[model samples]
Target: MSVLVLNTGSSSVKYELIEVESGERLANGVVERIGEDAGRLAHDGGAVEGRFADHEAALRAILDVLGDISPEAVGHRVVHGGEHFREAVLVDEGVIAAVERLAPLAPLHNPVNVIGIRVAQRAFPGVPQVAVFDTAFHHTIPPHAATYAVPPEWKVRRFGFHGTSCAYVAERASALLGSDLSAINLIVLHLGNGASATAVQAGRSVDTSMGLTPMEGLVMGTRSGDVDPGLAGYLARTCGIDADEALTRRSGLLALAGVSDMRTVRQRADEGDEAARLAREVYCHRIRKYVGAYYAVLGRVDAIIFTGGVGEHDAEVRAMSMAGLERLGVVLDPARNQAPSTGERAVSEENGEVAVLVIPTDEEWEIARQTLQSVRRGAPQLGDHA
Candidate 1:
């Protein structure tokens, strides 16, 4: 099946036309700066700079450029599925309403996601559109782990993000280890601008770092992860700062190092910048704590996966994160880890009990795969949801 995957953000939309059977990307592009003067669309080895009034306009332009390739299915990347969707499902009015109700949990993502769906519905009237959620894979998280220590009436609990990446990496880790996913224990660290640590036991998400929203995991580029719960109240009483906005956009490595990009933080840290050094230390320390915590959660982790932008390319960060963990049997060989390598490969010492691997995440491919799978299962046909 050829699936057109759409990941809609607040101000831009990213898309990829993927041929699932052959695992080849048929076509891919991104539309940026919606509702702005500097709008751009980059597709098929070409670029266009123009005005994109809204999501509908951006998608219509893409349709005009795509011309004749009719996808078997259209997949939408909806960030938070809440507790409703456990896997990919065909878009319908009920589904759309459910997603709408969950918008409060992910205000920055889910609303725009539904906008993309509505636009695509107009663009391809009869095509089956699938909503592949980022939180669906963690649906198996046991209640004990998902529960927060808050009042039951408040109702919020951990609904992990990065499920798609964690699921994809865990599958690859099983293949690399020559074991069935259902029989292995693994820890997946998705270290992108937004990061997470998931403990996968027997291919199921037993525990994860992200909670309720994406802002409660390991420190991220702009999001402050795992801040004290009393901060909001304290700040409100003191200076009346909006804690959510500040923490979500003005914290983490950004707040610590005066910049959010990990590459820049590393450079500045290497130059003996105190703030950058502390940022690196705090980031790695948070990861180390999660590694230890999830290790206990899983009991025995067969392999540790490092993925996403920072996890895949930053050797120094990887080294520091796993440092002093030899007792837990995670031994990264200095020679192997520092060696120049790319794609999915191991970096742990050969004799170590746990294998450490660096696998670049393919979220688009995962979304396409899930869409194809759901559609093949005779999932419900798309309805007039928009």
Candidate 2:
């Protein structure tokens, strides 16, 4: 049996077919710019540059590329499961309805995620579909960490995202450290266009940076993180701006440096652009703060694991973020950090008290694995159709 994983974005769909038994990626591809002119589909080393009117068309195009391949199960990356789901669940009509009801919580992602599930179900009727949530892994977070200080009647609390990536990298980090996962403490820095820091103690998430939603975490590409609560009302009165919209789309590196790409920000900073330099400082400062806070929370730190785009590729960010943390026993080797390498490896000083590592996140593989496990555990064994 094979598992087809679909990570559906508002305008793009990334698909991967994996053989469950061997853990081999049989095929992988993406359809980008859906609903826009000059859309493109690239799959299995081939490219088809054309407009896809909608997700249905994009998915159909993907099926064309897939040709004769048939997956036994499909896993959809549903961004917000709210408090309804703690783990991956078999997709059904009721589940779809529940997800639809929760759309307002993740308006930008849940609707499209539901679209992907519906499309995949149509494409592969009777094939089990599993929903692996980004928030599922963080369900282990303690009450003190997950709870908000607001009134209990409000019913709002932190539901961390990117748990799929965190789960994958935590295990990988444990393997690299040559320690039992249950015995090690870890700090996972997932820094992409969206970023978050998670404190993993004994393989369980004790705390995470993202709160209520993904927009609450570290300085991201366009999202303003940890802004003053009063700022929203102020913006509404003075600027006529919706606080949520401003935070989700107009702040962060884009607002500070005039661009969202970290590489571009770093490049401009290198050229002595003060705004870009300040942006970089703010970004690294936020990460450093979280690292220190998590270290305090854990008491004894085992390793600081870096994953995601910026965390893995930007050595300067990694080093600068941990820069004054020598007292915490978190030290980075300048040479090791700068060396170019794709595989998982430590950038910390040899035999250092704390290990700083770069482990590329593999969310797709994790989703597929979890989907397979759900299916094997008697999660609606639907009959396959040719």
Candidate 3:
């Protein structure tokens, strides 16, 4: 049976229909600008541009287009599972209610994801729907690493995101290294439009860059990662801006360079824009610092794996992030780092202390794989197909 993975966001829904056995994506696309004018639903390797008033409507359009693809199971990427769900779970009323109760933890993600789940549940009755938490993989993180120095009443903690992708890449990196996964300690740099670094020990997340929400850690396309906690209060008191407004809306590379898209930032930097240049430096510097921090955290690092859009494609970013870290046993070969390719490859020097690799992240495939595993474990008689 094919597994359909749905990752719903505040204003977008990214989906993939994957053949479980072979882990092949049958089709995948995203619906952008939900609840806005000129909304779009791009699927089946084609895009449709029009109006979608809400997540429910967008999902209806998606189901209409998925008429011919009869998926037996569905998996949803639920961003914030809080401390409740530590693994992928079959969606049920209890699960949905728990996700709803946890909405405040991921105000920008969980509510919308709940909407997608409910709508899809109605659209495809009886189909097993699984909720895979981004925080799930990081459950293995030791309490010392996950805890923050905050008030006990607040219950605030560092719950990492991009775990599904990290899990997949770490496993792939282990295979590439030909080392036992349980013996390997990997640092995965998931650099996309939204970026993060995860330190994996024994194929489980020991620490990650993103915390609580995707708005922490690395400087992202739009989200400010790791600013002083006092900045919000300062902005509110001095600049007359509210805390929430200051953080989730107006910050990060957008605030740094007056543009959020890295492509634009890169172009401006190329044209000798100091702000853009500094922005890139700050971005790469943040990554390098995380690498160093994680190195200290892990003590014995194996391979450094790069994934996601920027990590896989942007050679310069990869090189600069690991630039002066040769003393730390991390080195990238100049030629291999710049090699043009979409497939997985190691960009590190031969016999380098640590293998620096570029592995394209396949979050959907991971979700599908986990979903199928959960299904097969529960109901082994289910027919498997690719």
Please report the candidate that would top TM-score against the real structure.
2
After superposing all C-alphas onto the true structure, candidate 1 shows an RMSD in angstroms of 3.4
Per-candidate clash tally: 0, 0, 0
Candidate 2 per-residue lDDT over residues 313-377, each given as its tens digit: 99999989999999989899999999999779999999999999999988889999999888888
Query: Over the stretch 1-386, how does candidate 3's per-residue lDDT look in tens digits?
Result: 79988988666788889888876778888887676677788887789999988888888888788786668999898988888787787777778888888876677778888988888788788888888888889988888988888887988888998889899999899889999899999999998767889999988898999887778899877678898988888888898987665566567777889876677788899999999999999999999999999999999899999997778888888988999999999989999998887898999999888999999988888888889877776622222100
List RMSD in Å for every model shown.
3.4, 3.8, 4.5
**Clashing pairs for predicted structure model 1, backbone only:** none
Model 1 over residues 1-386: C-alpha lDDT tens digits?
Answer: 89999977555677899999999998988897677777899998899999999887898888888888788899999989887687899888878898888887776678888988998888788999999998989989999999999899998889998888888899999899999999999999999777899999999998999989878979988888998899999988999999888888789999999987798899999999999999999999999999999999989989999998799999998999999999999999888898888789999998579999999888888999999998988554434332
Instruction: Give me the overall lDDT of model 2.
Output: 0.88
The better-scoring model by TM-score among 2 and 3 is 2
TM-score computed on alpha carbons, candidate 3: 0.90
Candidate 2: where is the Cα deviation over 4 Å?
A: 9-12, 30-42, 45-61, 379-386
Better of 1 and 3 by lDDT: 1
